[model samples]
Target chain A: MWDGRLLRVDAREQAMINEEHRPEIGESFPVHAYYSDNQKVRIHSRIHYHSYYELVLVCHGNCDLMVHYELNAMVAGDMAVLPDKSIHSSFCPPGEDTQVLVVQFMPDFVYNGTLDTVDSRYMAAFFNSLRMKRHALFQTGEDLAMLQDLIWKLLREYQEKRMGYTVYLRAYIGMIIAYLIRRLFRNEEELINYLRDYHRIEEAVSFIEKNHREAITLAMAANQANLTYNYFSTIFHKITGHTFTEYLNLIRVREFERIMLGGGNSVSEAATAAGFDNISNFNRVYRNLRKSSPTQVIQGLRVAKS
Target chain B: MWDGRLLRVDAREQAMINEEHRPEIGESFPVHAYYSDNQKVRIHSRIHYHSYYELVLVCHGNCDLMVHYELNAMVAGDMAVLPDKSIHSSFCPPGEDTQVLVVQFMPDFVYNGTLDTVDSRYMAAFFNSLRMKRHALFQTGEDLAMLQDLIWKLLREYQEKRMGYTVYLRAYIGMIIAYLIRRLFRNEEELINYLRDYHRIEEAVSFIEKNHREAITLAMAANQANLTYNYFSTIFHKITGHTFTEYLNLIRVREFERIMLGGGNSVSEAATAAGFDNISNFNRVYRNLRKSSPTQVIQGLRVAKS
Candidate 1:
């Protein structure tokens, strides 16, 4: 099991095995907490990614978390920070009975769209995990135990949904993030680098989001960060694991679906409104990003609504 | 000692007795944490106020905190939430050896200028304290003890000035605020009312901050809140404990001082830049609000710098 053979999966095959998981989160709160065990692990054994940060703390038994070419073995009191959209999977041997607490939250849940330096600094650990291509893992220790206790309280608060639960949840998550930053990044230089990269990509991401409907291009995004087209493209891919065009199309497809699901728009109308000039191109990009035809997803949405 | 006579101080006398205390806080990280005991309390015994929220947790002995016409007798494990600029004083009888943990922070330190609903909701207890003319006091209990642990940790973090102390300090404070909201306001309606009032006043305050250099009026502020001039004035005074004109002039005086301290500007130049049209009128308002003439304060500033 210690052999490094499992780390040699081909890029194309890894992409084929990866799945996107969108955890259910309240729009206003944007945080979800739950527990995962071996049985749950088997059910979701495929490499998976989501568009929000996930923090996992092991409670019992042992498991291995794979992020790209690296594997981290985790045990009781061990914790892992999985940045958003990082392809990874978890595994536990038979009879291990591994249990882990999981917390998933959007960046907005913590910072709430404020561009303040300190606010973005809380996200340093998450961004570092993505940039390094290795999940941030904390082994069994006193600090990890303290954080585990907080995570348990967070899960309880989420389960109970008591009065002012959202406020409490946000506070708990903020504390956890702070703990991660204080532990993971030892010096000021590491944090500063992470913060700088976050802002650069964040600027490009924000620009794309604001003007995705206006036929924006990669060069325009690069200009937003004052970087050359080639360097910006390379950094964007390294950080996000997606080419700039791929990320842009993913956003456009998501917006298209949102417009359609809001009930009054036709497929072609949404396609155009979401920045696609041609239906064929829109359908192809939607399928590539979502692994489903646009029509099928729309039908599923309608069926679920009905 | 519990007699109601102490609660009958006249408003004019209270104003004369109340002093403005500006706690030193770093601009980037606007939080200051310290411990206060009877000796320190006596030094600051006169009723005083500051333009920042302060949380006080009693660690030992007994003290009485007088806010406006009300008094709260606080003992060990008691905590008090004092809103910004709320005239209040603490008294500990001789030999009590009272000690308390004090955490003062600007509202921006937590919410960071986000107008998000939940961000404002974290401030409910503070606003409620100001509106009700009574400080929010949490008595000894299990929950308070838990919060006390966080506060102690916060004070340690503040003292240590570690690598990411600001992030940790902010997290601890956020948790404390969440605990306050969860414990103090048992229901949603109270929180909703407090949140509404915060937003209303916050809107007018933001307007004054942004347009103070121009000619603005109480009527315009009322229009911002969509309330009549008389009603807005009443609510503003009830919430802030200062008449509309008093608060406006106080803001102007603060702006004027800020300009002068930045250097190179004559007193008249700074006063005009801060929206004061006449030097005499500026001096009168400055002396009334700050209890010091403009020239005197400016000279004091220069002397201190030298």
Candidate 2:
């Protein structure tokens, strides 16, 4: 949480809250919160990319944020929205005492497994950042204050993990995204065009979700979206941070997990029912995607049930 | 829309746009849009109440909005959120040339037949207004600007009626409500308390929805909410603007309509299935709530289908 208590923390504790918790594969809710004051300790300056969207708010002092190799100076009340797989890094001056709050959430956190156009619009700013080659930044006065307040509430809810915290987290995230989109896209025509294109991609995703049980291909999904295979593949990877095949496999793995947890099915049966052809191939894909074996997941589910 | 074109319209054309379109009892989408300029014509000053929420945004000049007998002087860029059945009227000085935009929508537009606490929180401001005895008025600078932009887009979308217009309308309405809640309840504890109270009412509503087919009473709902019967009755009426019996009857009428439209059910059968035991009482309540006969609705549905 971005509260006043953080101002008194010692130098040794500066990085304590900055330890990132990367979302695990198939995690139900994949939102992580972090706070850092770089004047007390060295900030992470390495250029890297992740498979989730990151929203950073500069609470105090100044810093430089690099998105897609473009450096932009940011002062207090500035916000940076970095899209998935967009290479980004940050730098803080030695004596500026720069403080920031960072929130990382997977695309699923916004989409929630649905292809609603409004949900796609929530992600418009992030994806638009890629095309514009400039990250979505909000520097307005009152709107920035409201956004900061929402982020603080989000961080507090995340840290406390109270009953129904995830519900509040999602609500706050939706509000933040809505605010960012309205502030970032001042041109109505640009917003409409972006939403139309996103709707097309969502159509393709909806196709995959419905047909994951069958032998589906990128060409089929592209046809559903009325886009060429290559074009669809490029934008799909850019927007989703996954190749078509990888995404399909991930969906199948998720379905397999769902079926296994639903009970009354053996591991192989669930795997085959999820469109995997053979046992060995399913095992390989499952391990590569989930970072865990099928047996281990089943054991974890059983333990949780007990 | 709140564009400049409205400024050029003649006095006779003023009420042309302000003509209210109240939502029919079973209307699929229950949202209406209106634009008014008192300079062009006489404003609707007669005190009135309706069965929907009304949101008013002042675009130019100033006006006085009276809610529940409390008069508030609103300037340009001010907004008023009036809860359902709240007696309200407006007064514009003779030469002030007050221009405003109004949006009216039923609770179903926001709740959409769900018991989600987040959805209830969106209506927190409106419900809280009754207790606070003053309507929700947003006076901040940038936030109000963003809200005006959204209302303009909403009015445009409503007038154009393009493809997926309802989707955009709902999205914009959600954003507006979110902004109002955040701005109105700056105190975090107040927000939490309001949400808790709203959630309790929503739980009672959810119970009614699930058991509407059974003979349920106010005491039953109060028990479900863990509130005293008298307290539950008072708060439920105040928050929902309907007595417990009236709300239950409305729910049943809605269900009966749903069943009749689903095809292959007689009006009597639907009414009985919706928890009305006698045909005469069913007809009376249906007529009182929906303002139309059951056979007329079935005929309309049939004609539309054909």
Interface RMSD of each: 2.4, 7.3
Worst 10 residues of 1 chain A by lDDT: A3-12
lDDT of 1 by residue, A115-176 (tens): 55554555654555444444577774877667778888999988987667776787788778
Tens-digit lDDT string for candidate 1 (B118-143): 54554654455543444577785766
Give candidate 1's error at residue B218 in angstroms: 21
| TM-score for candidate 1 | 0.60
Q: Which tens-of-lDDT digit does each residue in A65-177 have in candidate 2?
A: 76642567889888888766555567776767888988887665544333334334435544554433335777857666767777898899789764445545665666666
The CA lDDT of each predicted structure is 0.70, 0.67
- The TM-scores, one per candidate, come to 0.60, 0.44
Per-residue lDDT tens digits of candidate 2, residues B172-228?
A: 666566566566566557767666666678789789878989999999999999999
Model 2 residue B199 distance off true place after TM-score fit, in angstroms? 7.5
Among the numbered candidates, top lDDT falls to: 1
- The docking category that best describes candidate 1 is acceptable
- Candidate 1 regions exceeding 4 Å error are A1-23, A39-43, A112-114, A117-134, A193-306, B1-23, B39-43, B112-114, B117-134, B193-306
Clashes of 1: 0
